[model samples]
Target: MDQLSATLLSAPVLFFILGALAAAARSDLAVPETIAKGMSLYLMAAIGLKGGVEVAKAGFGTELLVALAAGLVLSAAIPFLVAPALARFGGLDRTNTGAVAAHYGSVSVVTFVTASEVYGNTGFAIAGFMVAVLAMMETPAILSGLFLARQKGGRLFAPELLREVLFNGSVVLLLGSFAIGALLGERGFEPISPLFRAGFTGVLCLFLLDMGLIAMRRILKTRALTWRLALLALVFPVINGAIGVLVGTAIGLDAASAAALGILGASASYIAVPAAMRLSLPQADAGLYLAMSLGVTFPFNIVLGIPLFRWIAESLGGML
Candidate 1:
């Protein structure tokens, strides 16, 4: 319970909520766009460097590969299963359902970033390769979702696929940073230690403040999401999180890594997937998926889901 409380009330989560409230209330508060972007780059670089340092200390192994493969499979498979269920239950058409499902299946980078902080706070150690896994898991579900849409006569263009799969900004930045971090390793990290390591949490708080504003704005834009859509948004994470815990345990991850995996699995992609969906599935309502993913699920995961999954992972880790 104490652990759960700590995770839920962490500075990051609180700031996120505060940001949301400010935006929802139409307050004048706003983070500068350039600062927000700069903060994002700093956060990603810091996380990548930290992961690389951990990898340097721990060295690479097969467990990392196993976890990566498991993440890929989940990202690819979850949309297929969930989209139809959502279509049936939430009264969404095939294309919209597919778009929403893909977002849920893919990961939210903010969630991943918060999970890292949660892991550190809980004294759990995660492997560097999981950063790679997060990057890998972004695109496949999008492709799968588009495929599902196409089956229902939705357009799926070659150039669209290329833009989404290959050139998406998040994927490019994440993978590029990961590669740079790996290349630099321990020696390179030393020189940049002061820049990347110092003030990470402070920066995260500012970013979450922005996130709060964005989330609130989204909620205002989408007042009162359908109950069915809301339920799907809420429930899907628990189901996917269970799958992640099982896979992580099977892969012999430590408690922290397992919990992190569950967080990643449970998180929905608001940024990458939405951008792709907007371009690829024009008929799909962005309001439905974006609101559910960002406004509802993202907040839920940050506030409650992270702690719950961490507890579950801890219990299961002990048993294993």
Candidate 2:
């Protein structure tokens, strides 16, 4: 409970609150768009490089393979589990249901990044290879979503979409940085570590502040979110997160990683998946999907889901 309080009260979270409040109050406070993008780039690169270095130190092994397979399987499978509920409970049509399912299946990088900070500062351990897991988890749900919708384009693989999904800026930056860190190792990172490592938290605070404002704005604009649908938004993360932890634990992941798996399962994507959906499921309702993810799920995961998921993972992982 104390840990939860501390986490909720932390600077980044507080800044997020401030952003929401300011927006609600119609304050003019805002982060410039260009600066926000710069922060995002810096964060992705740092996170990727740091994870790669961890993989380098740890060396490639069975754990890496297991994590990769686990991410892919989870990413692909989550849509199937959730799409039916989305259609029934939310009254969403087939296209919007599949689109929302894709978002839930694909992991949220920010949520994963936040959990990493919590684990590091709070004395729980997270695997570096999880970065690789993070990168791999980004796209499979997209294909799974398309399949569930059973709305393929003229081609099974659209060149433009494949380009978009495979080379999405976020994916490229993270994977590229991870590869670099893997090859360069800790020794090489030493020179630039001061820049990347030291400023991570502050940058995140800024980013999340912007995010809070953006999310609330969506909430303001949303007309499609019904009471039942809103309730489902909160419920999905807890259910899916628990499933993630259990799966991770079963697959020999440490407690922290397992908990992260849970968070990934719970989180709905606002960025990559939304972009792909725009291209692929052209008929889907963007306002409906993005509002639920950015407005409801993102905040819920950071504020409540993180601690709860971690506790579950700790308890279950310890029992093992």
In every candidate, how many clashes are there?
A: 3, 0
lDDT of 1 by residue, 204-291 (tens): 9999999888877887788537988888888999888878877888788887788878888899998888888878887888888889
Off by over 4 Å in 2: 152-156
Tens-place lDDT per residue, model 2, 163-263, is 88899988898899999999999999899999999999999899989988988888888999888878888998999899999999999999989998888
* lDDT measured at residue 188 in model 1 versus the true structure, 0 to 100: 80
* Model 1: residues with Cα > 4 Å off, grouped in runs: 151-157
C-alpha lDDT (0 to 100) for residue 240 of candidate 1: 88
| TM-score, predicted candidate 2 vs. hidden true structure | 0.97
